[model samples]
Target: MIELVACDMAGTTIDEHGDVYVALARCVEEIGVETTPEAVQEWMGADKVEAITALIQAGGGAASPGIVAAAFTRFKELLVEFYAANPPVALDGVEEAFRTLRGQGVKVALTTGFSRDVAEHLLASLGWSVAAPGVEAGDPGKVLDAVVCSDEVPAGRPAPHMIHRAMERTGVQDVRAVIAAGDTVNDLAAANNAGVVAVGVLTGKLDREALAAHPHHHILDGVKDIPALLSFPN
Candidate 1:
């Protein structure tokens, strides 16, 4: 049985209308590095700094720390404004699924590639707070057991630090007891690196072909099917 589920935010849980890639592409372009949305998509589950670095490298520029930092700062500003202007919507059945998992003594944590500020902003818009099991605040429908972000760790997805941090914060020691779900290859790679179940969901930018090209344990139509995947008899 899965004791904890570490889910990705933008595509897997919250629907942000592809604003993340847009902001990333815009920021990189500002630095004279023209990039396509598909280029940014390749690093969807990575840290913004890492993503910016990749963009710089891809566009034949030196991905210095200074350049990555500058690009990322601008990306944060743009992303914050974009989300504020157009608040995101939760995926269908996400909240219900959280409640169901929590009710079954299973911990549910929302992990994201975005930094804490952006993550908190998105959570606040959804009326959710980042807290542990008993000290939750805000809309009960939107509460999660924990929230882990890329900035909190040394590295993000495909490195497994975020997943390890989520497990640490949630007090789950065994990797076999966790399941990581998201809409990109990076998410699956992270889970695979962490030695946990890697689940792919189709609600994000990548289609089945893209996701299938990566390593994963299972594929679901959407996160709503997670409960069934876990054999939760409700």
Candidate 2:
């Protein structure tokens, strides 16, 4: 039995309309770095600051601390404006899925590449509350058991820290009883690194083909399909 399901936020649970990527691209371009869709997509599920730094270097710009910090600040500003104009919404059936999983005694947590501020803002906009790290458990009445952000961990996706941190936050020790699901390659890589069941969803930037190229156990249409895939009892 799966004790916990660690999910990604932006594309997996919330439909932000890909504005995050647009904001990232704009920030990098405003820094005078040439970036392509492919370049931006490659860092989709990564820490925003890290993504900006890499994008700067990859685009042949000097990734100085000041430059990266400035770009990140701009990205945050752009994202806030974008979200204010077009509020985010939970993906269809995701809340129901969360309820079902929690109702069945499974702890559902959200893990994201976003920093704490951005993650909190997104969750607040959706009116979702999550338990902070180091808490033994979360309130069952809340939408999520815990939320682990990239900033909370030493490193983000492509590293297993975030997933491991999620497990720690929820007090789940056995990797065998955990599932990590997301919509990008880094999500899968983190899951794989943590030695859990890595499930990929097509609700984000990557397509079925792109996700298939990475290591994953199950590829589903969206987060809504996780309960069905898990074969949870009705």
Candidate 3:
């Protein structure tokens, strides 16, 4: 029996594309860097700093400490504004699945590549508050047994360390006791490394072809299949 469920926020739980694109593009313009949307898409599951580094490199711009800081600061400001302008939408049937999982005495945890601030802010914005009763919406922490942020990890995706950390803290020694759900190759890689069941959802920047290249046990059009995937048998 699966005792816990862990999920990636951006590109997985959070609707991928659109607002993020505009925010990054506007930030690029404001920071005086000419960039193309396709370049940004390529760096989709990476950390903010890594993305900035990649963006600068691809755009033929020099990566300086000062320039990097300026670019990230501008990106955060615009990204926050974009989130405020449009509400975060959780994927289909996710809330119901979470509720049912918790009811079955299963522990819920979240692991994401997003910084602590971004993760908390996004969850709060979307009402994923996970209180004792469970994540009713954006505030998911209150209900989840634990949360592992990228800042707390040695490395980002494609690394099992983050998932291992979450499992360690949650006291899940057996990989079979946990289910890792994500939307990117990095996500699948991390899950596979941690020896957990990997489930992929096509709610992110990657298309079916990209996702199929990885070792995902279940592939779905969206997160709507989470409940069924868990076999809650409703």
- Predicted structure 2, TM vs. truth: 0.94
Taking the tens digit of each residue's C-alpha lDDT, what string does model 3 give over 1-234? 887788887777777345766766666666667888778776555566667777887778888888888877887787788787776777766666676677676766778766788788887866666554343434443446677887788777777877888788777889988888888777888888889988887888778888888798877776556666767753
What tens-digit string does per-residue lDDT give for candidate 1 at 51-100? 88988999998898888888889998998888878879999988877777
| Model 2 clashing residue pairs (backbone) | none
The stretch of ten residues in a row with the least summed lDDT in candidate 1 is: 130-139
lDDT of 1 at 97: 79
lDDT of each: 0.86, 0.89, 0.74
- Return the lDDT, model 3, position 85: 74
Evaluated with lDDT, which candidate comes out highest? 2
Against the hidden reference, what TM-scores do the models get?
A: 0.94, 0.94, 0.84
Write model 2 residue lDDT over 101-152, tens digit each, in one string.
8777788899988889999999989888864443332454377888999998
Task: Give lDDT: candidate 1, residue 168.
Answer: 90
lDDT, candidate 2, residue 43? 90
Identify the runs in model 2 with alpha carbons over 4 angstroms from their true place.
131-141
lDDT of 2 at 172: 97
